[model samples]
Structure formats: structure tokens, C-alpha cells
Target: MTSTPGERERRTSERVIALLMLLIHTRHGYTTAQIRRHVEGYAELGDEAFEKAFQRDRALLEDIGVPLSLEQPEDADARHVVDASALLLPEIDFSGAERRALLHAREVWSETRLQTEVMRAVGLLVDPGSAGEADDGLGLPRVVQRLTPNLEVFLDAAVEQQVLAFGYRTAAGAVSPQDRPRRVRIWSALEIGGAWYAAGWDLDRQGERLFRVSRVIGRPEELPGTGSDAPARPADWNPVEIRDRLLGQGEGLRDRVRLWVAPGRGHSVRLRGQAVTPTAQDGAAPGEGWELWETDRPAHDGLVQLCGGLMGVVQPSAADPDVVAEVLAAWRRVAEVHDGAPPPHPELAKPRQSRYRQGQRERVSRLLDIVGLANRAGGITKVELADRLELSPKALDADLRDLQYCGLPERLFPGWLFDVDAESDVVEVRQAVDLPAPIRLSLPEAHRLSAALDTVAQMPHADDEVAPAAVTAAARIRQVLADVGHTGATTSVRPSTGGTDDPGDAAAVVPSAADGGGAGGHEPPATPVTSFWDVHADQDTVRVLMDAVARHRVVRLRYHALHSDRTTEREVEPVQLVQSGVVLYLQGHCRTAGAMRTFRVERISAVEPTGEIAKARRRPKKTMLTPVDTTLEAVLAWHHRIRDLADDYAPRLEAQDADGRRLTRLGLLSEDAAIALAGMHAGDVEVLEPAELRQAVRDRALAALRRLETAVRL
Candidate 1:
């Protein structure tokens, strides 16, 4: 009797698992005859049928990321042995804090789609039975939210750098039910005020846009076609910068408004409010709980809308005749919005879109370029590939994993598809696919490069060789654009003021001041071109610290601590570099303090690598995308417009206040963090406690104002 297809599949799966177990647990090689005798399913099949099934099973295992290997028989006594790693799952080395954070996140997101993902990830890393038993006396001091299903899909696409098209619900069904669909390339996913938003490059608008996860009506499906047409992002594009810009949407000049939110609805609000209280106030409805909060922020419709229904203006008393009508009017407008009418400011109700992060896209493009170049070179080692891409080995491995599925659908059998063979010490690219020639230079790249070349050519006493070379390269790039039939005036090249007369000679085709080096013919040649590597610290010092971190070496640093108000020498085992906003911090183990510490790169006056491997290796080996400090905790408050900044600092949300203000416990690295918060927001930020930090902020503010006065005089 013939077996049903389902039966055959079940049997096949069982056989595959059995085969895997045999290979994984066996101490010695097993021949085909020996395997047939030992295994159940194979015993029922003839040699031909068994061989076909074995081949199919091997392919399935390989496809599933199983590191399977076959050792060939070389001599009479030797046999072909199937060799594989002992464990099917890769070991997870998350720190106690990270695991705890993940555990809490899983619990928080339990009912949502993100909960499953978090649980799965955590489950794979930790034993399910031991999940929440004990704590390590460490609080990551950050709120973790679940990813809506829509977000997970978009995030995956973003990681793959794939373009997506999806339906976005601009208005609630109670408002505008019509579906608004758009095509975009996902650049970032951020959580602000406990809501998730995705920012990306809008294909139709030829600009960047943001979408709220809750506003997204359905799962985003991958758009058809290669992402070749997507414009290249700028090399200096910073995601945090774009996120901050988006977060600042509709913000006005500072408005300090005291308010109270209903109990249980004040978490987002309290993260930025000073003197947050959770209790029913005098006029609160009986049995109704209230959270009182005060905050200073730029007044935007977003703030008013956030406070509506859930919170209300408490100070500038509602009973006061001077402001009673204004407060009543604001609440009335909010009431109208909830009643299915248009918001007083429709824009405030809509999600805020931000400019595409140019730097991240450039990094993705560079990754693709490096992979293509290395693959085309034939058999380039992984080390060489990493060196060429200027990426760490860990980073390079991640890129390769993402790029493995980057080709056109495998159904077409295109020879241009790429595959990575990462078995040996070297990474081998097999079945290489050629990259489709990029249609044109990214606008920012061309614009910036042109300005740099022009500046170099015009520099006083510039080296003849360098100046001429810059001019020649610029002209060639412009010529390529012109040859591609671009009709824009930016394609034009003019002669340099003192360039060679020969058309074929270097500097012969430098664009004149009028042409602006063939970059839109707009900006003057002297316009400054921003460098991607601009930083507050010495480049040499940063390089040294980065090397120490990578090599797991100790470094002696002359570091300035804002809390202590002094500079001192300390030996630190470099862990990793973290970027918060525009500042870079070196997180490591400090021998002086006998604990892990975070030191700002800018605060380090000098760094000398010890050249010895560090003994302290307790710090997590992986990089953190944001600031995380287990040592110091500061309870403070602020306005909501700066929510992105607060999240970047990884502050733990406590309670909500009226209109975009909330209380939070922020994890601090050093006094620099307080200074950073104070400086970034000026009077808006109130550093509460530790007395030292508060004084530091005051001193820094006074010093900043003094510097401003001095500059004004100069």
C-alpha cells in the first residue's frame, strides 16, 4: 500500500531527526550499510531510495543553519564521518541585567505580538524554568515595550535593508477609515512615551517619513522589485538625530505647565515631570486616583492632546478667573476630538515623520559594496573582508547573515545570487552575483564630495599633487553623471582658477566658483562640507580606546569625572563604545573603583594602552545600542518633547503628570550625564537628588552662560 503524502512527510521528519541524533551523538564514523542496519526508516528503503532521502535531509539541515560537515574516507581503515557541533542552538551569553530586562519585557509584552518574540528569544537563551526566580540586584533602569506585529515585520525588513509597502491608517475608523498606503525603506524603530514609531525613506515623497505602529492598519508586506531605486542615505546620517528631530515635531518655545493625570494613566507623563505625586487631589472625583506633575516644555498641540481626558491642567488653577476660560477651552477641544470630530490641530493627531537617517543607509550601502567587492575578488578571507569594510569581525558576521537572503527570489535560479561559506577561518563567497550598477551618486555624497574637493583646491598653499588630484576626481565624477544623460546644471564642470590648460591633464576640468564643483551649482566653493567622523575627543585618543576595547586590553586614562569635579588617572579594561545623542562613551571596568564604569571619550584627556590582556571580563561582550549604567541612578523629571533624549539615556519611567511631563529614574554613568541632560534642555531639566549632581548641573549651566557672554563680547 502506498503511503499518503502527509505520512511520508512525518516519516521523513522522524528519519531526519534520527539521522541528526546519530550524527551528533556518535563517537565514530558509520558507513551506509552500517547506518541502514542501525536506522529504522532507512532499513525499509532500497539503496537508491535511501540515498535520495539522505541527500534531501542533508539539504534541509544545511538550509536550517546546521553546521554539518562530512569527513571523507582517505584510506582503507578510514570511513566517511558526519561531523557537527554538539548543540543545535547557539549559546546565549546575555548578562544577568540583560536577561532580567528581557524577562521583564516578556512579561510586559505578554499579551501582545512582541511578547512571543521576546519570549522566544529569551527561551532560547535561558531555561524556561529559571526565568524570574531571582534578581541580581541590578536594574537596567529602562522601560521595555512589546513590538506590535506590524513593527516586527517592518523591523525585519529594515534589518535586511529591504523596501516595504503597507497600509497606514492615518485616522481611526471613528475618524477617517480610508486606508493610506505608501512604499518606504525602514530606517529606524523607536519607542517614545511608550508608543512605537518607525521612521523610513518614503519612496513616493522622495523624502523621509515616520509611521506609528498603532496607526499601521495591517502587517507590512515586502514590496516587489529590488531596492535598487531607493536613494542612498548620507554617510553622516545618525538615526538618533533623525529620531530627535521627529520627536521635536510641533514643539514651541518652553511652556511650564503643572497638571494632574488620572491614576494608572500617568506613566508616560511622569517620566518628565518634577514633584510627581500619586494620590487623589482636593477636587478629584470620589474614588478617582490622580497623579500630580509639573513640567516645563515647548507648548505644542501634542502636549495638550496627550493630557486630554487622561490628564488635566492642575496649576494656573482652573478656578482662577484669569486662566479658567483658557483651560476650559483646551479641555473642550479635547472633548470634541474624542467625540469623533476633527482635532483642533489635525497635525497633532497624526504621526510625526522625520528625515531619513542618512548615516545608517550609507553604512548599509557600504556593507553591500564591501560584500560585492570581496566576492568578486574570489575567495577573500573573512578577516580581509572585515578589514576592507572597516567593520569588526562581529559586525561583519551580522552583515553577512543579513545579506545571505539579499538576492532576488531563489526560484529564478539567477547566477548572480550570493552565498557565504563560513566554515573555515576564512569566509568564502560562493555563486557570486554581480551588484546592479548604482544608477547615480547619492545626492549627499555628491554634494559633500564636490564641496570638499573645491575647498581643497582653493586652500592656501595646498599641495600641488593633492589639489590637482581632488579636482580631477571631482571632474571625472561629474562627467560620469553627465554621460548618464543627467540634464541638471549640477552636471556641468568649469575650469579651475589656476588649473592645467590641457583637457586631459589633472585639474584641467575643475569646476569654477559659479559651477560649485558640479554640485547643484548652488553653494559657493568655500561652503564647509561636514565630515562623518567629527567628534568632541581627539581622534587619536578615540582610536586608541577603540583598539583597547577590541583587543580586550587595559588602558590608563587621565579622565575627568564631573561628579568629583576633578581629573585623575585610572586603569580601565575597555569593554565597548556607546554613542548617546552625539556624545561617545567608553564603558569598561575601572580598577580604581573595582566596578564597571562608563567614561565619556571627551572627558579623557589622555589614554595609553597597557598592551596587556585585561583580567576583568565581567562586562557583556556584545555592544549596547544605547546607554546602560548599573552603577548610578538619578530620579528626575522633564518635558515630553525630549522623550527621545530621555530614552537614549535609558531612564526608567515612574509616573505621569499633566501635558508631556513625567518622573523617571535615570541610570547615570558619571556627572557628565547630569550635565548633558541639563545642557541639552537648559532650564527644562531638573536634576533631583545626589546633591552633587544637582550642584554639578548648576555649575555647568553657569559656566556655559559665562562662556556665551565671553563669546558675545569677543
Candidate 2:
């Protein structure tokens, strides 16, 4: 495309203004060695080039319409840094006409920058005869290239709070979003994929706006615009704050948000909302009926838009409709675009989400205790629950205090306090409160958690703690339950009327505790049991193991095995440390095994670090109870086969839609030490290769069934 003489003149003027504005934006800033680093990259910069650049930039910026204020640097950090307070710009807001003009500009010249190269690429894709012209669809690439660079520069401008002037193009070839493109001061920008984007209050567009760099046709000027320039802000403006005002979207905004959703859309609503919070009519399971999201703020509008077709907003905040209209417009325009539309605007998306939480469980139970105990018996004493969870009197009080703040706006939800009734132990559940299916905590089950957490809760708080490993210990418990093949599992835990059985409270995995350096994250699979405690592990033991891992040391152990019903002493090399749930298990090579194995940390009678090794041995236990093919080659082959089989076997086969879910259960041999031959990933199984081992499991299951039937009397 050839530029008209008029367009050529306009282009030259825009570039000059851009360069000047660039210099002005950098005025208040100063740094050492800047000359060497920043001065070398441009087309033709000199020894005094940078010093000249800054001055020229300021002059050019003022020549436009931006009025920038900068204070002289103080002697202290003068040579190295610029003071922010001194350099400031006036407020800026785009008029409706200006925004519309800007949007028009964006539509037109957005691709003109790379027109030359872009056309060449298109020529390769489409024949002139077949396509009529090579440039038919080639313009998009040109626009796409320029937009990123301009957006990148603008993003930097936003972060730095510096003024910028660049040519903006509209759909009808107008330079401005309004009637004509004019030199303007851009105060800030937004960041995406390490690049900057500048979306602001467009005076021409009449609302918030987004500008893609691809549409910019001129260089950036750093100086504030002067007298005749229309871009300068009036004095007394906080550009940075203004930027936030535009980009903040709706933080902490509340509205009586009403969403009318279709029946099947309940799950969609929860997932889209990114939290299971159903803002329905005061109390009820989210999907049982029409879903309502009672938001304290303006976040509700986004949800309504997302659930569109299946949902619509009712009696929303005044801002809702406008925002909705904008979204729908964008959706309509981009929805069917498979040619890869630009990334969606971050300003439009909901803010990054916080982690999910489970607040209702303890709230209900504690509410039961509060109403049942306090109102009738002057608040149940710590001693009452002391024997139940095996908690100390002081710990019981701590637990109660924990339940107190659960669900108030301040705490954020039913406050966790006296919300429970102590007399009948009835919780003040709303009319919609559905009684939770009971949770069965067998003493044995509780004991496993108790033993696992027993060691962790007791560990001396380290100055700096690494990741927590309790989940691994918890996984062992879960695996056992899964093996039990239970579904819709519901059981009740009866409090002991007898005095406290001090298995010790092992509720460390409780949701109430969320620590940055605590029990969550990935763990490698378990090593075979070489020296693990066949018995139970206490909390103190869990902590010891964690310490061993962090410090990279070995411990002398006195381990008890339930299989042999005996105890043995040995020195084991601590290898990989694993934490599952509240229990800490060591998956290190053991001297006892002559290889690696899983050692329950709590069961170790004592831990004495003879020396510390920086690296832990990374393999499974060498010793085994049964004489199995133990060579590395054989182990590898077995591990490979099992994985292949697991892929096919994991999903059960059944006759009906629901028949196969539970009845067609498969259990692999995990207890035998030899079963550990499979690689670590098979924490679920130890058969080395899935392909062959699946057949072996069938053979074993049949044999076991036969044995069981024969034992039964007719």
C-alpha cells in the first residue's frame, strides 16, 4: 500500500512527537551505568546522546499537550534513582466521542505497520488468480505484529507511570478514536505475557477502552504536551492512581446480585464461579433448585454474563447492564472466530482466585456442641472433649476458639462461635441446611490418623520448615479405604463416655490449618517396606522423619513389625522422605534391606544422626520377605507391564450404566514386600509391568475365591 502525500506528512509528524514524548517520560529517572546499557541499542546514539535524548524528549512531549511535573533529584540517591513524588501528571479521562474515534482507529490501521512483509507471506499462501488479490486477508498479520510492540511499550508506561504520545488509527483511516487521530498522552499500561497493554478511559469511545499496539503508527514521545497539544492533563492529577481506577475492575464491590439460572446450569454456575458458593435463597444445596449467587459485591455480573443462555441477571447493580452489553458484544464478535482472536482482556476476566475452602463441616459440628453444651451447662469444659479427640485441655480450648470465627463477614461466612448449641448439641442450621451424611471414624481409623498426626503436631517448630509430608501418610489410610471398596460411605463416630483414651489428637490435616509450608504437594511413590513400623506411628515420630529429610541425615531405628510380631534394631540410611496425609514415611534406601524401602518415621524408637549425607539414595529396598525375581531387569519388566494393564483395568467393565461402578472391583497384591518391585509411581501397586501382572492378579483372585468357598460349610 502506498501512503498518500498527506498520510506521509502525518506519519513524519507523529514519529517526531513520539520520540520527544519518550525522552520526557524518562526525565525524573537517573541511574548509574545507564549510558552503557540503554544507550547502545538505538539506531544512532552518541556519547552525549542519552543526555540529549532526555532533553529532546521533554521538549517534544510539551510541544504536544502533556504537562509533566518533575522535581530535581536529591543529593542522596540523585545519581542512581529518581524521586516519584516530584514527577507527576494531571488526571486524564476520554470523552465518549474520543473513545468512539479511538475504537474506529483501532479497526482501520491496526495492521498497516508490517504491510510489506505480511503481503509477502500471504503471496505464498494464496494464488493471485484464485484469491483475486494477495492482500485480501493479509492485513490482519500486519496489525497483529504492531499491536504487540505498542502494547508492550504501553504496559511499561503503565508500570512506570510515564507519559507517552503515539499515533492511534481507527477503522475509517482516522488517526484518532474520534473524528481524527491526534497526538495524545498515554499515562499507563497493563501487563500480559510479559508485554504491556494500555486500556484507559477513552474520551472518544465514551467508556473504558483497550488499545492494541498493532494499530499505532508512530514513535512514543516522553515529554508532557504543551499549549496547543490536546493530550496534556490539567494540573493536580495522580496518573498512577487513575490507572488503577480504570484497571481495578470491581474489587470489594458488593451488590444485591440476583441470578436466575436454569436447572442443569447449577454445576456450571458453581464451576464458573470457581467456588462452590451458591448465592441462593439463604440456605440449600446449590443444585436442588434454581441457583442464586448472593454476592456482597459487583462480582455477580460476570457470573450472569458467563452463564448467559442458561442464566440471566435480575435487579442487578446499575453498572451490570452496561458491562453485560459490552461483554455480549465482544462475545458475539469473537465467539465464532476460529482464526485465533486476540487473547481476552484481563480487565474483563474475574480476578485471580484464592484457594478453595471447606468451612461448613466443623461449623455444623461445633454449633451442635455449643448449643447442646453451653446454653444448658455453662459451656462444656475442655475436659469434656479432652478424652474424645485425645486433645489436652488447653488444645481443646484452642480448637473451640478456632471454631468461633468460622462464618461472619469479618471471618467471611455462619460464624464459627456459639453458633452451635451445647444442650442438644444441635447446630443452628438454617431451614435449608441438609444434614451431612455421617462420617464414621473407627477408633482404629482414628488411631491411624492419630498416630500419624501424633508425631507431626508434637514436632518442635523449626525456624524454617520445608514442605509437609502428611498427605502421603494420609494416602495410606485412603488406599486402605479404597481397597475396602466402600461407596457413599457414611458412618458415625461416637464420643467416648469413658475417660479420654490418649491415642493423641491427630487432626493436623484439619481444614482449619492452612500453612504455606505445610502438608500439601506432590510426592514420589513409596519404596518397599524394609524397616517401616508395621505398627502405628505417633506425631512426634512424624516430625523426626521430616527433620531427617530436611537435614539429610540417617537415624538408628528400633522398628516393630506386625507381620512377625517382633521388634528389631538396625541403622538405616535415610533416602527419599515422603509425607502422605498427617503421617511422615521415609522412602529411603535402607542398610537393613541392602536397598531402599518405606520406613514409618514415628515407629523409629530413636533417631541419632551419625553423619549427614547431602544426597539420599534413590531406589527401592533390596531385601524381601519372599523369594521373588529381584533383579533390576526383572523389576523394570514387571513395572512396565503393570502400567499397561492399569490403563485397561482402571476403568471397570460392567453390564449396565451403573452396574459396573462398584461391583466390578479389582484389588492388586500390595502387602507382600515382593509387590514393591513395581516402580515408585505405582504407589497403588507393586507389580512391575501392568501388562503381565494384570493376568497374575486374575489368577490370584480366582485362587483366593476358591479357597474362601471351600472353607464355607454347605
User: What lDDT does the true structure give each of the candidates?
Assistant: 0.45, 0.31
How does candidate 1 score on lDDT? 0.45
RMSD of 1: 20.8
Instruction: Report the number of the highest-lDDT candidate.
Output: 1
Please give each candidate's TM-score. 0.33, 0.23
lDDT of 1 at 383: 68
Model 2 misplacement above 4 A: 1-147, 151-165, 169-180, 190-215, 218-236, 239-254, 262-264, 271-293, 296-304, 309-714
Tell me model 2's lDDT, rounded to 2 decimals: 0.31
Per-residue lDDT over 1-714 for candidate 2, one digit per residue giving the tens place of the 0 to 100 score? 997964543333333322322323354443423322432222245658655655554443332222334434657333322222221211113233222221212211111221221222112111222322211211110111122344435533432234455666432233443334433334333221112235433333333343444446566655444313222222222322322232222234333343334344333233223323443223332223544443322222233223221212121222244443443343332222212222221121221322223132222332333323333333344444343223455544544444333222221122322243323322232221211111222212222232222222222222112113222333433444344341112232321121101111111111111111122222212111000111124434445554565566777777654222245676666654443322345665567777656554444555666675646444343322122333311121111112222221222221111111111122333422222221112222322233344334333333322322232211
In TM-score terms, candidate 1 sits at: 0.33
Which regions of candidate 1 fall more than 4 Å away from where they truly are? 1-532, 543-554, 609-621, 624-643, 654-665, 668-680, 686-714
**Could you give me the TM-score of model 2 versus the true structure?**
0.23
- Provide the lowest-lDDT 10-residue window in model 2: 526-535
Query: How would you encode candidate 1's per-residue C-alpha lDDT over 1-714 as one tens digit per residue?
Result: 999964565455545544544554455656666666655577778889988977776665443223456555667443435433322232335444334433433332211333333333333334333434453212211113323456556544543346877766432112123354677766544432234556556776666666665556566778767456664333334433432243332234335555554454443345345754433222332124544566544222334333321222122222223233343444433222222221121111222232222232333344444444454445557766554444578877766665554343222233333466545556655543333211123332333334334433332111123334445544544454345342123212321122101111111011112111111111122111211111234445655765576567899988765433455789998876653323457888889999777787656767897778965465565545444544667766554433334544555545544444445666776666555444434334556555666665555444433332332233
